[model samples]
Target chain A: MALASETPRPRTWWRRNQQRLTPWLFLAPGMAMFVFYVIYPIIASFRLSLYDYDGLSAPEWLGLANYAELWTDPAFTTSLYNNVLWLVLYLLAVPAGLFIAIFLNQAVMGIRIYKSLFFFPFVISQVVVGLMFAWFYAPNFGLLYNVIEYFTGKGVAILADPDLATYGIIAAGLWPQIAYVMILYLTGLNNVAPDQVEAARLDGAKGWKMLWYVILPQLRPATFIAVVVTVIGALRSFDLVSIMTNGGPFGSTRVLSYYMYEQALSEYGYRMGYGAAIAVVLFAIMMVFISGFIWKMVRDERGVH
Target chain B: MLHLRTGAYAALAVLLGTTAMAQQRTLNYYADFDPAPLAAFEAAIADFEAANPDIDVVLQNFDHEGYKTAIRNFLTTDAPDLANWYAGNRMAPFVAAGQFMDVSDVWADNGLDQSLGSALASMTIDGKQWGVPYTYYQWGIYYNKDVYAQVGVEVPATWDAFVANCEKFSAAGIDCLTTGTSALWPGAGIFDYLNLRTNGYEHHMKLTGGEIPWTDDSVRATFAEWAKVQPHITENHAAIDWQDAATLLVQGKAANYVMGNFAVAVFKEGGMTDETLGFMPFPTINPDVARAEEAPTDTIHIPAGAKNVEDAKKFLAFIAQADTQTKLNMALGQLPINAGSTVGDDPFIKAGFELLSTTPGGIAQFFDRDAPAEMAKIGMEGFQQFMVQPDQLDAILERLEAARSRIYK
Candidate 1:
């Protein structure tokens, strides 16, 4: 009996240290995956940015040279400028989503079907959406081209026009993005405090005023998620641009993501080192927003406690 | 019952082990092809597997554009035994990087040096042939005979006569040359022909090889000649792709399309018959300069890191045979490199074969194939922009010259 008691019983060990060890055991796989996939690649990409590798050969060390070249590259400048335009304009979808959500928030007959219909675009793949928009904006036989020609006496080929191509693609991106945000807001609206809205209505608060002062305050979590996703989506805008324009009509629609792809893998030549530098820049931009969101969440948690 | 089940499992395991041992030599082939040529290659693969029963041929095919991206990754990691590639400067980088095997011994053992004929030189780099070229085709002006008759002109053999015919087409209010520059390569086709005619083949090759500057006087002279005929080209060309431009030719809305012979199939599919569709060589620009045609050849190579190197070489030799080439190219609707290989009775194939074989200055692999891909992209983009705004020539050339210096360095 003494020898048996001296041995380590796994059941007793689990009982004694369960709370401390269980959470960490649960987190181990996820943490290991995040470290391997996300953290390791970021560090490796940073290291690769300082070299000159053509992907098929041994890498040559060229510290800061690739970054230095990017400073004067006309294509890089155009891509960065277009990325800024994308970020600024992509935010318009959030407000547009809110507007659509409010308009359909009523309990009218067959409104459930209408809500599902409104969420339809978000379910379709971005590639299909891009193709649909491309056909819609096609030069001679497209719907938009014909409509424009009927009014202006000249058809506008949106994807083929360098000045307007990015805008056309962003409009395609917004179709699905707006649908996604509207679904989020609709769910948030379902959980809104009705008593507060009714009290505000008694105090002469109605329509835009009530939505602003009373309802929006309750919709803060939804709004925060909407903004976060929109920001990330804007920065990662690649599929629509790739499908519709391919950075064509003189490389005018290229974003940092597409430009990096063109440099790293496209027929332009496999300059992996240069491509890594572009990715680092895009990541740095994304980190700013990511950190801010985390900081706000931490402060909110502390206030709640 | 338990004893019988275990016995059955042991037998099955032994059978699998023997089958695996028998299929020891497996050769992997990575191919990039359009649907039409892919069928031909598939048939050839079947024949090769049947001929060499001991060797197993594993084939993976990717579409043309997707393969371009996938090659860079696969060639370095998990490389196939053999992979399809292009010749000339297209293969130069891989050769320089030591990614492809030096298959000169296969060339010698099979007498490919004689069989390959004109393509042998292009396949060779640094005194060693890197790959075997299977098929190639010619690029020329495909014109509408009905439009030619409507404009009251014949096929012009010289540059001056071509310009006069364009003038007649202009008088008749039909665009003489319908090209799609939205994709940017059709415009480069025009630039290639003009340079080949004016400055000759050597200079054109040198320019694409990045030995000559974009702002050189010869290049400027080619552009000057091109500008003279710019008004005859289709307007608002940036809006449509090559197929749409070909549609204009099929509809008789445009007179001519300077493209590869592959476009003949498109024209035929668009209801154009032999009487309406005709092929002509790009008109002569310099009386003294010999004609050099754009005939891009498609080649296949064995990767240096391939596991089944000996079997790969055997496959290469088998495909290098004239009979194999004839069967393959005949199915592909392209001209085979071997003189003994017979192409289809298709008149365009005959004309392409005759033109490429008879040309004094030989062939080029088109702009995109000849030049480094980075420089080619910028060069084609500049060509497209120039088509839109010809007055921006100096600025465009300056930009291209800068890109050339950076890329070639």
Candidate 2:
């Protein structure tokens, strides 16, 4: 009895709380990593936005100067405008993917082969896609150039024209993004309730009505995922712009992410503070959509429970 | 027991290895050299090592593009004894940040002020020499002789004659001037020549030094000269790379290319023999202005944080030697910066040597090297924009002026 009373208090406490503490202990390592890499950097970037640093010398405090400069900077404005264009145009991938998914979701012979072929683009690296598309749009001897020349008597170099370069890069990005969305919807379509689909078909619901009323409702999870991925992809578009245009023909094709890189780290750029300010703005823009997504997810979980 | 004995043996071996390394000084060199130049540099290092048997030189080669970013990181965190960089304002940032060691004493000891005189000004910042220049290649018009002959045109001696030749070339459906601005620096080469010719070396220096406003009238005058050939430049050049444009010149679709001597190799590789390829000085734009040339010097500097400063300085002195530079540039197929060094028998190298040696006006580094980096990027983009849309000249100038105000301050 004396020994039982003298048992270490810490061990007893651990025993008492083991059920709750075990999960948290398991989560500790991952949570620590998340705090160090993700949370810390976000806060650091916010603080860095107010300083004037060139990545070599000491950072000078500048208050709101970096943010204020962004408001007046023409390059920043162009990047913002291009980002908006990307966001609007990038959403088109979701519907296009849905259409392709429906078309490929069939029981015909060799449908799997066709589906895989359609999914091939997503598997390829972004750099390769950018290179392929660059060649396709190249002037003089490119395939698209030759075809356009045959039709219009003069080939258009889409990447060279400031008015069209952003669109050209966006089209390249959509090629792979659409493939990714289609794959997601394809998997979603497999789990759909076939009985509901049959009921709608028997009720004389045709193509559009049946899709809108029964199929799409069942594909809500897929649609939500597609929208979220597409939005994130649009916001973080650096690779295609870097590969295809490099914000050239007078920086016309720059998106926010690429512009931030240009301001901070490119061969000619070392304005870390200005880059941080641009990053802060981009983060804020993303937070709006991300928070909306989180709110919706929480509400959906509550409703389900 | 056997495993424990083996582990003990491995530990002893590591300890011995470290002790041996500590006994001999190691000079770490970080360089970004293409295959040809890398071989030349390695050969030079062998000679240096043979002379000083105790000092070991360790070389870490990086890809050219990646090195630009890597140098910034390593210079701060893990500095090497030696680093390869460029001359002029390109090195200004490192100098200003005190990341590069001041090597004036080495220059004084070696009498480099006389032998490396041509690049002396470029290597100097605030009256102190920070690096040693080994090689610089000339920039001029490399033309397709066959294209010139087919168009029934002779190489021009004056700007007007060049403009006239452009009309004839255009009538034959040939691009008069071809450059790829996708990377954006090629267009600056053209601007450099025009600015150098129109305003002479002093004014050009003033303009790039940010003393003169970008929207100044003299700057507009240079643009006005550029306007003459804007339409005759290759269409859709913004989508192509410099090598692709070189292909156009090689195929005789383009008559002339205002490029550095490096393009001569590309021209030769594309099946142009010595007879088919011809080099000429950029024509006399304003005969009154003394002739200036563009020869961007490649240099080596000692990092401030370098551990083996003495051996690194010895390496610099060896690189500055006339014979060493002569042999190095021979392999590099470039012009040696040492005045006493002899150039090879290559016709392009000879022509460049002659063109640069006799220039009364001072030599200007290429535009990107001469100007601050931010200004250079904005300026090159503006040049590309102007090439595509001459109508946007006002907008482009205003934009550059705005950038200048923000960047130079």
Candidate 3:
């Protein structure tokens, strides 16, 4: 008792609390980074949305004027509409990926080679993919243009037409996105229980029935991941739009992400507050999905515990 | 003890070096120049250093496109002593934000009023000179002479004749006018020429300066003029780049291209000799309107936060000198802004010099330079849209009018 009393008080406190504090100490660096890089910027973007800033001049408090302008801005509407189109069209990757994964699942001659070939698009850079698709859709001497010209009397330039340009870019984005989804589903398929498949077969479940009842349930984790990634990917679709059309043929191809960049940072753009407002709207939209995801994840984690 | 001795020596060296640097003032200059022009500027810098032995000029080169975005950041955060930018309304935002230094004293002390008289109006804002222009290039119709000869068309001297030639060229299975509007600025060249030809320089300036409404009939007249040639502009032009359009002109698929003088290099590279490539002033639209020309001037300015203001002014004065501009522009293959500067012997250069120097109405900067950036962007898109769908002219004009009201205010 005399020895315990003689020991330093802070040292005893540290020894007593070390177990509870250890994990937090380990987490401190990463948490600090997240707060600084991610949380801080998001809060700052929210604050900036209420101001009018040209980046060169001091930011003036405008009190939601930028947001009000977004409602009236035609470009903002077009961008929002295109973003919806991208989200709906981009979701097509999941089923298409599942189909490809199933088709390529069988063991055949050089199956690995075929699988690798199928996975190749996702492995290449988005910029290169965008460039390739751009060339393919280019008018006059492009291969697709020539083919179309041969079929019809007049050639159609996909990117030149405002009505078709967004769809064309989305199609380009899907080429690699489908491949990415396929790889995820392939891994998920590998983990399916053979005993369950056998049991289902015994119960007269086959083909469509087998997949719907047994295979899909087992693939839920992969499907969840694929959907999450695709949602994020669709929202942040900037590079392909930048490389392919630069949101052009009269701003018809602008998605929300690209429009935000155009308003704040592009050669003609220095409207910081306006860009931040757009960013805020985008963040609010993203939060809906993210919160839904987090809610589900938390409930599932609780169930597991 | 040995480590302490080494640390002491290092500190001594740094102290001596800093004192030495302090004796010779350093002027940091940021410029965006292509390879050839960079070499020319380097040579000019060498001469400047030789002339002013006490000053050191350190030039940091940036990529052309990246420099536009970078300048905004650096000007506010870490400004250089000197930086390169465009003249007219292109510099207005920077000038208004107090990012650029007012260099009226530099112009006054150097007598630039007489020497660089051609660029005086463009360099001035709020009745004060903000920068010194070094080089400018003319915008006009660059054509394929071989295609014109094959199609049995004469070089048009008037807008009516030009439209007439367009029909003949289109009948001959060649595009009359070819411009790639994918980047959008190329279409602005066409608009600038059309507006200048239709309403003269004063009206064009007023239109770009936000004094005139886009819904005005005068602006509509320019679009009506544009509509005359719209059908004959190359199909799928919105998908192709300027270089690709140049290729079309080279291959005789397009007869004419409304472009700046810099496209000559692309034409030459595509195997078109000087004999086959031709330059003509944009044809007359209205006989009553005085002939104006588009010559976009590129200038350099000292940043407001510059440390070496005196030396920076000296550098600007040196750049404005006739001999310096002549040599610089010779290497740039562009026309010098200084009135006393001599142009090179290139045929295109000579043609541009003659065309600009003899203009009766005035010299106007290109559309993107003349108008505020947001207006320029929206206007160019509207122009591109008009080229695609002439029926949307009313809607496009309304949109532009809306933008102008918001932006200018």
Candidate 4:
């Protein structure tokens, strides 16, 4: 009431400029939050990477020492290798998802139910998927163990073997990832211009030829989204690795995300600065992909305009 | 309108007064992740509150693994009045940073020196007691008595007897030790026992303190001794968890397992009784070396950031009482550190009490608790690797030595 009584000058100014300023005013709150939570933290983490902190004492400035240490650290090398493995393996989901989407695209009885059933794993959390897969691969009594033993007379404990553990987790991760991609492709298929398919059929283009020459190019937008999400998900593969192996048998399953968490937290006792360094590396890797995607999107937008 | 505003102010003051009168004080207590212990802890708090009605205890329990990470966050900001944490080197960093309130006065006032003698040294830092030691349990070789009887071998006290027993168990088609190294720490237990038995407790302390290198002769001997038992351990042991390994022991497929006294509950849950389960200290490698056992102690502390110092002190004193310790440990299936507390009739508890109380070289907290956490993580990983491939001892040691030197500095 006091401000209203005293602010005629401010009110007159607002009335004069509100038309031009309304859009920015509307965006201010959200943009400020983004800057604080996202942009500020990224800058802070980069700064912290140059110091040595244990989240307790005052941080000591050791510019580039953490980065220097990373080169010689075998654990870092292993984590980097595993991250690349995850990236390469995770891309397999896009095509697998498209295949499943095509298979389920028919107008059959209870087809909707079948679609939802195929999308079940994606609906559940990654933690649950990891647990289910852990059970499925458990040494003596797991379903996978039983099947393998039936054929070879020896059960394979997939998660227990360090050499095999990361691949096992990646496979578990792909179960839901594939479902996600399938849903995206299903949505894309719905809007895929049915006339084109019919026209291609009239030209006697069918099966793989039809999919390759007609359907796939039309589904590029969905493919783009699937590839983007898969890349992000693969790099952020901490939950399954943490839940299943905890980067064990001997830290063999650590990706950059899990390794950063282990350093920053866990009973390993906060090496926050070193953890920040790892995060910076992960962020730089992610930025390369993000920038490429954004560049393509911008080019597409320009072409559309 | 003026009269109405006056009345609203009067009412607010009255409500605040009544609330303050009704609940005079609150003590925020954060408990560690252990459901059974939390139950007993609640009971103890109930008694304390009844005796001192002015103070109200607000308790929150955390999941064990989550709590391990959350403590670092909460201890520095929004600290609870009292927190449950491990003793020994695990508590050292928090103490060194002055996050924990030194309650030496409480110890003096309550005469806890007499009751908590067993865990005093571990809880003390820089001549001050930072926390109250409540409960601790012993770690030893947990064996299936049925297998031992069938094999006709008695409890082994010397290294030679231990190896011969393992050989006998192996000959009888039972794996000698059923341990899960997938989590990494179980393998460290084997390392702890071997180091304590071979080099004595002093050397073990020196090594954990980073005064001794990993490639030291005494450390090599400890690993060398551990290598002998590697042959008799379960195949593909890293693939299973401790509970799974315990299942093998309970099912009589494996002869023995080395674990903390906590496994007694798991074995009991597996349908084994006190009669079939036997507990023995890790055998002595050097008869002349004083016997130091692994007994991890759990302590309660008032974080320095706490709001209720007086109440937290009172709570700590109440927790240190023999009755409280007895009930807490009894519920948790562990031993009370209170010297005056009676050990429950559970034979395993009795044996643990007997072993820990009588150790001439005193009880060292387990490997993960005794060493700095980062070094401990790397060291335990090395131990696990060595168990899987005994020939990689030198490489593992070199890696551990590198980590240890870097961490300690």
Clash pairs of candidate 3?
Answer: none
**Residues A192-216, candidate 1, lDDT per residue (tens digit)?**
9989888999999988899899989
Clashing pairs in 4: none
What tens-digit string does per-residue lDDT give for candidate 1 at B266-303? 99999998888999999999989999899999999998
After superposition, the stretches of candidate 4 with alpha carbons farther than 4 Å from their true spots are A1-19, B1-25
Pitting candidate 2 against candidate 4, the one with the higher lDDT is 2
Regions of candidate 1 where Cα sits further than 4 Å from its true position: A1-19, B1-25, B46-56, B167-173
Interface RMSD of each: 1.8, 0.6, 0.6, 1.4
DockQ of 4: 0.62
Candidate 2 yields a Cα-based lDDT of: 0.93
Ranking, TM-score, top scorer first: 2, 3, 4, 1
What overall lDDT goes with each candidate model? 0.89, 0.93, 0.93, 0.89
- How well does candidate 4 score on lDDT at residue B25? 80
Q: List the residue pairs that clash in candidate 2.
A: none
Per candidate, the number of residue pairs that clash is 0, 0, 0, 0
Q: Rank the candidates by DockQ, best first.
A: 3, 2, 4, 1
What TM-score does prediction 1 earn?
A: 0.92
Per-residue lDDT tens digits for candidate 4, residues B81-153, read: 9999999999988988889999999999999988888788888889999999888889999999999999999
Model 1 chain B: weakest 10-residue lDDT segment is B1-10
DockQ of 1: 0.56
Report residue B5 deviation for candidate 4 (angstroms).
Answer: 35
